[model samples]
Structures are given as C-alpha cells and as structure tokens.
Target: MNLPATDRRVLVSGASRGLGRAVAQAFAANGDRVAVHYGSRASDARLTLESLAGEGHVLVGGDVSDPAGAARVADEAGQALGGIDVLVNNAAVNDPHPLATTSYEEWAEQWQRHMSVNLLGTALLSHRAARSMIDRGTGGRIVNVGSRGAFRGEPDYPAYGATKAAVHALGQSLAVSLAPYGIGVASVAPGFIETERVAHRLVGEEGEAIRAQSPFGRVASAQEVAEAVLWLASPAAEWSSGTVLDLNGASYLRT
Candidate 1:
C-alpha cells in the first residue's frame, strides 16, 4: 500500500536549522504535520517550529547518538505526530580531524562520534520507525540525508565520509528488508549546501573554490535539497527506494 502524500505525520531529526529546517518546512507546506527535532538547540528549533506554514507541528529533543535517547526521540515523535508516516534522518556530526595534524586520541574520538550519530543513530531510528510502520500495516517512507563526501571523499573529516557511506549502505539494506512491509527507504547525497553553519565558508577564496566545484558555479540552497527529500518520501517515489539521489549540481559524478 502506498502512504498518503498529505496529512501525513513527519519526523525530521536535527531540524533546528539548515537543511533539516528546510525539509520540515517543505513537509508542513505540503499539508503534513511535522515533528521538528533538535539535539541541543531548543531555541533554534522553536524558530523552525514557528516558521512552519501550518499547525499541529511540534518540537522534539534528544541525543540521537545514544541508544536510549534515540528510542525516546522516535517514541515521542510517534506519539506526538500520531504515527510516523515519514522519517528524515538528518541529524549528524561532521568534525574535522585531519590525520596529519590531529592526535591519535582526537582521531579516535571523532571516529566514535561520527559512528555513533551518523551511523548508529540513523540505524536505531530507522529500526524504530520501520517497526511502527510494520505494526500499522500502512506504507511509509524513510529518507536519509547522506553527503557527497560519502563518494567524493573528506580527507580532513574521514570519519564523516566513512560513516555517511555506511548510512547509504544501511538505507539500501533497509529498503530491501522493509519492502515486504511497504516501507520505502532512500538517501540523498548532497554537495556543498549553503546553510547558516557554513555561511562563513561561502565567502572569499574558500567560498569561490567551493562554488567552482560545481558546474553551476554556485552551491545548493537548503530548499533545493529539501525538495528532493520531499519527493523521495512521497507516495510516487516508492520505486526510487534504495536509490541515492545526488543533488550536487554536477559537482560529483559516480560510475
């Protein structure tokens, strides 16, 4: 069975700002009730919640990196939204720890952090949401916010790249496993996106270089990525499950 497009309950993790916020707004604009989740940015999350286009939107907070916290987040969102028809796994940690300059301890810590949040967190949440979807006997969608770095590489943030690659793989695995239960799973691999956190990097020489990476000579807006995600979670996108749609403006091509 295909999930309903509108009036669905959506849970967008790490939606306090940036891409996640844009995704939440898109779903709300499409007539879906959204649960805007935040890790430690309650104030920012409130701003996102206030900016939403409709009512019935809520705010949920928890540390997705922890198993208990992940469970709580999924449970609270499920209860508040009535049931999770769509889940966007957007929460992640991307810290730089270049091998040449960073100490062994720092490298290990970064690896663990990336693994816990980017990989484990997404897996745990997907499991919970999938089980709920199974119980409801209704179709659902899961869209993961993967990164271009998963394929393009991140020398300074190797852990981020590695974990995101793992996320992509996990999404594919779940797509197959959940197909019988009518849960479609997919991921988006976006290149340099223009967000508040990365505003400083989009100026001067660094900014120019980043933009030049794309054939369009500009980076993507959060709204652009959100639109792709919105479609991925739509009823029409069920066939696109297990696919990783790239939104890099011709920046990175994979064979």
Candidate 2:
C-alpha cells in the first residue's frame, strides 16, 4: 500500500501510557497508522490503541531492555504496520540511585538497566527501522526521547542522566551515518513532564519547586512533547537531522 506522505506508518515505543501514548495519538490524528509498542503494560497499550483517532493501529509488546526483545519488537511492528516510516524511541528506565546512599551493587545494576534500555534499545531499534526504510527506498524519520537531565544532570538518578546523554550522542551519530540513505534522525531533551508515572512527585512543596525551575511556572505536558516529536518526524523537518531540540521551556539554558 502506498500511503500518502502525511499518512505514514509510525512505531511508538512505550506507547502504553504517558508521553509515548501522546506521540502515538498525535500521529494517528494526522492520519498515520501507528504501532503502539509496550514493555509490560499490555492493558494500557490496548487503551492507547483504542484512543487513537485513526484506524489500522496495532499493539506490539516486548522487553526493549533485552537485545532479542528489541529485535522482535522492531520486526513485529514492521510486519504489522507494513513497514515503519517513523520510529519514536521513547522507552526508558529512570530510577533513582543516589551515590550518597546507594550500594555498589545497586549502582551497577541501575547503570546496566539504564544502558540496556535507554541506549542499547534505541540503537538496536533504530538500526532495524532504518534498515527497513533503506530497503523500501522510502526514507524515514527517527526521533529519540532524551531528557533535559542529560545536560542539567540527575544527581539522584545518575544512570538515567548518563544514559540519556549517550542516547543524544547516539542519535547524532546515526543522523550522520544514515543521512545518505535519506533517514533523518534527531533527539528531544525534555524537562520535567506531567505524567501518570510522575504524578506523585508533582505535588506538595517539592512539586512547586520543580515547577518553578521553568519560567513558565509549569512542567511540560505529554501532548506538548509529542507535538515536538511529531514535527521532528515530518518531511519538513528533514533538515533538522542531527539536531537535539530542547523542550524544557527555558528551564536550563546550555551555552
């Protein structure tokens, strides 16, 4: 099937909820078929699939932290969607492991988990999707969901910060390597976002302080970040390849 440029096949990892769900919905609203990928939340993924505005969306489940699982995810989504034209690498693991209190074993475990999911998962999936795009000769877009913590630092979750930094670098590397094949790659470093997973932290005095970090006096919404991802994946954004777009609302300025 020859889909219109505006209605390409999109694969959104971690789309079971939160920002991933928002990204999937945005593409579906734009008339694109979406493959909603989930790690463990099958029920939540089904809800996301149902919430999409368009048809032909599918639910794909896999553990992105594992090499085999990541490969399976890309293959399943590609087969179901009839080839992915846009790949959103949004799956990640962000758990706190403070150096002052964490044990060596715990710190090592956290680092391994973060690297496997945030960095390795994104690289493997991008390779799979990019290969498919190259074979199809249609070109594609790869938008990685990085974090502002990559630059501002995550004292409490050092692994997350480090892995996200690596993700940004990985995207830049792939952008250059894949450009000749017509694949555009980019990353979004978002600051604090209001989502179900982090709703508990968005309350009380701590929440107020978090919100105050941005001059806007509020954290970003999932939809807002999703819109940026959507734009990055659009044909008009081809020139934006190799760019790391900051969506922190001026919370942290980099020089």
Give the runs in model 2 whose Cα sits over 4 Å from its true position: 1-4
lDDT of 1 by residue, 1-255 (tens): 669979999999999999999999999999999999999999999999999998999999999989999999999999998999999999998889999999999988999999999999999999989999999999799999999999999998899999999999999999999999999999999999999999999999999999999989999999999999999999999999999999999999999
TM-score to native of every candidate shown: 0.99, 0.98
List model 2 lDDT by residue over 94-135, tens digit each: 999999999999989999999999999998899889999999
Error of 1 at 239 (Å): 0.4
Clashing pairs in 2: none
Global fold similarity of model 2 (TM-score): 0.98
Per-candidate local distance difference test: 0.96, 0.93
Q: What lDDT score goes with residue 52 in model 1?
A: 98
**Worst ten-residue run, lDDT, model 2?**
1-10
